[model samples]
Target chain A: MVAAHALTVDDMREVRAAAQGGRFFALFDPNALIAAIARSGDRAAFAELFDHFAPRVKGLLMRGGASAELAEEIAQETLLAVWRKAALFDPTRASASTWIATIARNLRIDIARRETRSRLSQVYEILDEEPPEQPDATLSGAERDARVRAAMTQLSADQYRVVELAFLEGFSHQDVASRLAIPLGTVKSRLRLALSHLRGRLEDLR
Target chain B: MSAVHRPSDETLAAFVAGQLDEGLALVVACHVEADPASRQRLRDLQAVQGALLDAADPVAMASGPRDVRAAGQGSRSPASAPSAPEAGMPQVLRPYGLGPWRSIGIKVAMRRVVVPDAEARVFMLRAGPGIALPHHKHSGLEWATILSGAYEHEYGRYAAGDFDEADSSHVHTPRVDPVEGCTCIVAMTGNVLFQGWLGRLLQPLVRL
Candidate 1:
């Protein structure tokens, strides 16, 4: 499987020290791979994650309006950030993909502005420290992703449109209203209703 | 279910999408950092964002994993937290530039705090113990979070880590708590207009 592709002696020092070192039959679980990277700075696992996610992130960034070159650069930066911040990944709080998406979002903002993003996380990155992790009881990344996808499909077309504009494409409520030729109240209500429905479906995690 | 004033769900959604202006995001970040419930909400919503990303059509990258890995080498630098200038100030605001505190009214003082990329003017408002400010109404959005001590308006008392939002529709005089006084970070969009005779008297001389 994916684990088999990572057994090569990429980093001689980390061969047996990593979780992926001898487990040829091990599944390519992103969370487990991330833990292995954090546990031993596993390059192979990082490579696997990058291979699995970079193109996806690049595509997503392009969809969000980044140029191909910028999207490619941002995707690479996102993964590098992933490698750097693997230790901060909390599976219970957010899945690897979700965390990666957050990283990508931060990078896209920074890259778009072409400046040092004053986002708190950037400062934390400079400080090389994060606030103490708070304990959270929630679904794992994959399960949460599945649930969110299921919930999104249940939204009405109008509600989904609002979500796509307000969330996926990062439109403001006023902008979403203008884009759809709908009233501001309708945009806000649709967003509220959609988020509530998705939030209700996600309540089992609590 | 009960908590101090927090940003609305729509606002949080915008924050999650990286769509909020920097000043508003900072205020919300303070609230989210202080409140675990909001933090969880942010994560839950981000997962949905991740799902949306997953559905995007894949594009081929010009560079491969090896190229990314190679480029990432030697990019890691040691990160150190800046020495905090004031106690009880939220960590999110510790990195930006801050100006000296300036006295404006009898007990109220204001200081400029720069938030990079912020459209709204950000500042720190510190008041002496048990002082009542003149009643004023806002023109645009105003977000204030207590960093130290407490303040009470018509709405309620807000202590450390408490967030208060006032729009043009919100008008009230905020009185600092007697014992602790108050220090709050405020991000305001428009001017604050005084409510009474003070409106015509101090409106020109006093600045918030």
Candidate 2:
């Protein structure tokens, strides 16, 4: 009997070779793959799963402002979470990116909670636990891609940099100022103005 | 239309990067949860990240085959992991650090304390009387709350219990009352550009 995940890269060599031939990969369902490997303890499936999703997870974390090292760490943690809870990969619920994004979000929350406990009394604790439920009339991935690109294009270089540093590097204004050797006021103004600009761009998209 | 308080560029960036500490992230997340306009901005930035990922050149995977290894052993369940309330206080303080104090040029002390994996640092400032912090602008968002004593900013006077958030476009000089001395906590992202001579001289030491 053929093992559920016995196919190796060698076995899929024809497909890998065809990856360069403008041939589309079969619409492999990530959830089914995750389930199959998960139930059978198939390492090959796990490796394939990691290879396909790790890059995107890294991308999301980096975009969210994690450093390359931090992003790698989060990505690893996310996959481990996936491995541990592979049964939770309900394809009907969300795409892998969305699910992974949710994982990143939760981990982010866990980290934030742990870090800011000392000053707890000073600031009101506001937990954002609501999942990013896909809206009933949500746009397709391609539409989202177009809309987001259009919105991003409108920000100024400085604004874009501020956004990138804040989200991608996770630098606070003071941290950003310290790193760039600028004044606190300047950092604040740039970020403020950048957000306003981003808002305007988004308004245009809507 | 509840003021549609948009997150400062830095705040948005930090949120996207998953760097803001828990307390602050919660604060911002609460705001985002209530504000749809703000949520749109977040989605836009996330998409930008997706595009960047789509655009980057593919890195080659490791070559040469290896023996097919068995799947790793299963991990412990959530119930097995130590609970949060059980981890003690330091785990709680993992997001905000006990920062160091440094001179802020005019008899003021300032330092950015590090918390592991945080995108932003917590700022603790202690300034004596007659110290006017340099004229500067923000690169991202800033949240400042007074802890002790009092200080006057261009916008208005702030005492204890008053929390203020400044977007990237605001500029100001903070003058402290020496008799009481001022200690405040601020969360900020992005760089600052100092305006004058003293600012230039102290630029290296007081980058934040």
DockQ of each: 0.41, 0.16
Candidate 1 residue pairs that clash: A95-A141, A126-B79, A127-B79, A127-B80
Off by over 4 Å in 2: A1-46, A55-73, A83-145, A153-161, A173-197, B1-6, B33-45, B48-208
Candidate 2 per-residue lDDT, tens place, A52-111, comes to 666666665555455667666666666666666676554433344545555555554444
List, in the given order, the native-contact fraction of each candidate: 0.54, 0.21
In order, the first chain's TM-score in every candidate is: 0.69, 0.53
Residue A33, candidate 2: alpha-carbon lDDT:
59
**Compared with the real two-chain complex, what DockQ does model 2 have?**
0.16
Residue range B34-124, candidate 2, lDDT tens digits? 4445555555555555544444333322321122342243453332243342132222233344555677565767766454444454556
Sorted into a CAPRI-style docking class, model 1 comes out as acceptable
